[model samples]
Target: MSEIRFDLVTGKMVIIAVERAKRPHDFAIAHQEKKGSKDCPFCPRNENMTPPSLVEIKDGQGKWLVRGFTNKFAALNTEVKEIDVPSLYRGEYGYGVAEVIVESPYHDVTFGNLTLEQMKRVFHAIIERYRSIVKDEKIKYVQVFKNFGPRGGASLEHGHWQVIAIPFIPELVNREVEGTQEYIKKERKCPYCEIIEYEREAGVRLIGENEKFVAIAPYASQYPYESWIIPKEHQEKFEEIDEDSLSKFVEILKPLIEKYEKEFEMPPYNIVLHTLPPRDIRNYHWHIEIAPRLTIAAGFELGTGVHINPVSPELAASILKLQNL
Candidate 1:
């Protein structure tokens, strides 16, 4: 049997086709234990390999725990102040900031492998750069994202995350903003906050929770094992995360990734942070979305701008909860 679901944020349709999962699993990943890449620029003692640090965090021994540097192959740079579009056509110079956060000192340790303390340090480095980048008045939105393994779009094996600050709001984020605004107008409340409250009570789609955060498989999940960690309150900005909340955020995230490791066998996945832009958006709640690339986007999904998810989010949540972290 099949069912159709609509995502509130993206307004995209998804086909929940259970028959698609009738086949055997295809996500058996034989992960090789990686030793240090001697020439890897992100490794320790490779300071000379990359551009000087934009910012960094140091441990008690004064060794850099996490580092932030401008991307050598930056998609956008601050060099171009502005560009005027031709009257006949619409375009502008790539005028923005592209930076990378080297998540850890160890070349092989990923977010899942790092000590909880190191994960917090990585986030602090990310936040430092994100706060600095967003301060630019010309920048409209800043995106913080990570790519892990092959299918997730990682070119380098070393653990790292990237932040790209752009001149205008991107389409995906804009759609989300529109969705939140419409939900508020119609129901006089925040959609995400409502979702958190609903899921907390329902418990079927929930994976884990703590005092400040709850991890859940969104009701209209677009991918397999898709999970989201969100604040219990109505915090709209990731930059506003205090030390206590940051620790709580890390607490919930660690186990979800561990669950992925146990269930998917280290499958490639994307982690994206969706937060309010520099401009204000009322009633919007910032959260992190983990989209595992266990399935591909075929013709119907690509052409029609819809997704066909084989696993029901409810079943996925149940299976994920069975795996102990």
Candidate 2:
């Protein structure tokens, strides 16, 4: 059966077509693992391979558990002075920040295998880096994202996350801010908060929840088996999360990743943390989106701005909930 679902934040539509799952190559069988580790820049003993660390989390012996550094090949550089341009047509100097956070000292260890303590360190390191980057008034938004496996857009196989600071708000984030404001104006309530309550009450799309966080398969998922983890209380920025909430966030996230590992054999996936701009905190809710690269978007999706999800959020949530950690 096929059904259409609309994204509340972006107003984009997606078609849920279960029958399409029968098509060949609809889902991936296994997550590709990196073969060579000796020459990996992120591996231990390769400190000289990358730029000096901005911040490093260490053990008692001072060995790094997590490290953040400037990307060697930065897409944007703070060193570049801002260019002066006219209003009619504008272009700026590549003035921004690019950083890479190595999640583990070991080459092969990933988020799926990280212990609670290690995960905490990683999260804290991310918060530290983000806070540091946003201190510069020129940096408006900091995007924290992870790419795992080849299909997930990782040229190197080491487990790492990237934080890129841009001078302006992204288009998608702007859409979300505008859409949330519109929804609040019409409904007199936060749309995401309402969604949390509705999904919790419905239970069909709800995966699970902890004291502070909830995991759910969103109604209009853009990708197969796509899932989201959000705080129960409305929050506009990830940096505002307290220690307790951070712990609870990781508690829920762990099992969600385990479910993906078990069901899809540790498939390639991306974790994107969506937050309001550091200065702009109104009419938005922060969330973590896990999009598995199980299927590729072809011409139809690119041409029409529509997605074809082969699995329904209800069924996907049920499957994820049933899996044992």
lDDT of each: 0.81, 0.83
Consecutive 10-residue window with the lowest summed lDDT within model 1: 26-35
Total clashes in model 1, counting residue pairs 3 or more apart in sequence or in different chains: 0
- lDDT, candidate 2, 113-159, per-residue tens: 88877888899999999998999988878899998878887767888
Best by lDDT: 2
Report model 1's TM-score to 2 decimal places. 0.86
Per-candidate clash tally: 0, 0
Q: Which pairs of residues have clashing backbones in candidate 2?
A: none
lDDT of 1 by residue, 62-99 (tens): 88889999887666656654455346543456677878
Using Cα atoms with residue i matched to residue i, what is each candidate's TM-score against the true structure?
0.86, 0.86
The runs of at least 3 residues in candidate 1 whose Cα sits more than 4 Å from the true structure, single-residue gaps closed, are 1-36, 81-88, 322-325
